[model samples]
Target: MTVRVGLTGGIASGKSSVSSILAELGAVVIDADALAREVVAKGTPGLDAVVAEFGDDVLGPDGELDRPAMGALVFADPGARRRLEAIIHPLVHRRSAELEAEAAPDAVVVHDIPLLAEVGRAGSFDAVVVVDAPVEVQVDRMERERGWSRAEAEARIAAQASRADRLALATYVVDNTGTLDDLRRRVTEVHAELAARA
Candidate 1:
């Protein structure tokens, strides 16, 4: 049997680190963020749909999707954000399914979905691993890593599902408030449990 794990966390919560560790442990990792990008990349039907919906201005000079420009628009407007999700989500789902189908029968397939809770997909997986950190740690990490101002970081955090909501959905919670070594240990423990189920 396959063990499907949905891994999620807030911005800067180190979910990617846990996902990387899971990959190293032989889990078949399917990254939603990567599929999101691939779907809307330069010469695709996804890009065509986006341009048709939002216009050509969403494209950068090099004919690629202007992510910053798109982010600003979607972040500020709920309707625009939903419209964008409507375009991207289905495509990502289709691609993700294709990847998942390619995994071995007994694989522990980890789907690293940043908005798993926000998108109401927590129950779809056999297990959900939530990588968590305090709000302050998240804010600081976003500031240092993404170069976002305090206000910008907070705004992005506010845009996602609340920390409480995400934790409520977790079968395993990796508290990522410490060093990389600590995160690795926690993730490895979780991976072992998931792999056993597989």
Candidate 2:
């Protein structure tokens, strides 16, 4: 049987790094963020719904979704953000299911779902691993690595549930407050464990 693992964490908590390591270790990783982008690509129903709801201003001159513009609007307005999520989340779920179905029988499939906790899908996976870091550490990483302003970083953080909430749902937790090597070691350990279980 395929082992379905849900990997999640706060913004800049190194979840992506951990997920990448798992992928390199031969786990089939279905990245929700990548699917979110795919589902909203120019001609999809997701893009059609978004355009109808938010109008042309949310599109760039090339007629593609203006991510920065839509991001700014959604982060500032809860209702707009919900509307956008309503349109895209279902599409993402569909695509995720497809990916899961396509996994090899012995594959250890990791669904890197940022909002796994928020969406109440924790039980959908055989195990849920949360990559964790202190909020201040996340802020620093975002600012220094991503070149995001403090306010921008904080806004993204605020959009998600508290760290405590994520931790409560975690079947396993990998703290990411340390160095990259440290984080990698933790992921390597987890990857081996998942492979054994598979």
Candidate 3:
């Protein structure tokens, strides 16, 4: 059977790194963020819907979605964010399900969803893996690694469910509070366990 692993975490929590390790170990990694962008590309139905609702202000001069402008509008207004999610979430869900169905028997398909906690899709998977760190560490990593301001980082964090909530849904937890090597070790361990299970 295909093992659908929902991998999630807060911003800057190293989910991508861990997802990469899982991919190296033969897991088919489906990244929701990448799909989110794809579904809204210039000619997609999702983008048409977004343009119909949000107007042309969200479009860049090149006719592509202005992601930063869209992000600002959503984060500043909950209703707008929900509207955006309404347009994008279904597309992500459909594509992810398709990928899951295509995976081999005994395949470990890892879905890296950044907002898995907020989106409430953790239970859709065979296993939920949460990558986490202390609040201070998360903020620091966001600011230093992502160049987000402290307030911006905090706002993003606040928009999602708390770390405790994420852990409550997790079947496995990877604490990313240290060096990359430490994170790699954890990923390797999880990979081995997943391989054995397969």
How many clashing pairs does model 1 include?
Answer: 0
Superposed by TM-score, candidate 2 places the C-alpha of residue 57 at a distance from the truth, in angstroms, of: 1.4
* Every candidate's lDDT: 0.96, 0.92, 0.89
Best-to-worst ranking by lDDT:
1, 2, 3
lDDT for 17 (candidate 2)? 89
Give the Å shift of residue 141 in candidate 1: 0.9
Error of 1 at 73 (Å): 0.7
The candidate maximizing TM-score is 1
TM-score head-to-head 1 vs 2, winner: 1
52-99 per-residue lDDT for model 1 (tens digits):
999999999999999999999999999999999999999999999999
lDDT of 2 at 95: 96
Compared with the true structure, what per-residue lDDT tens digits does model 3 show for residues 24-82? 87899999999999999998899999999999999999889999999989988999999
Candidate 3 wrong stretches, greater than 4 Å: none
Candidate 2 has an lDDT of 0.92
What local lDDT score does residue 154 receive in model 1, on the 0 to 100 scale? 93
Please write out the lDDT profile of model 2 over residues 31-138, one tens digit for every residue: 999999999988888998999999989998887899999998997898999999999999999999999999999999999999888889999889899999999999
Error of 3 at 160 (Å): 1.2
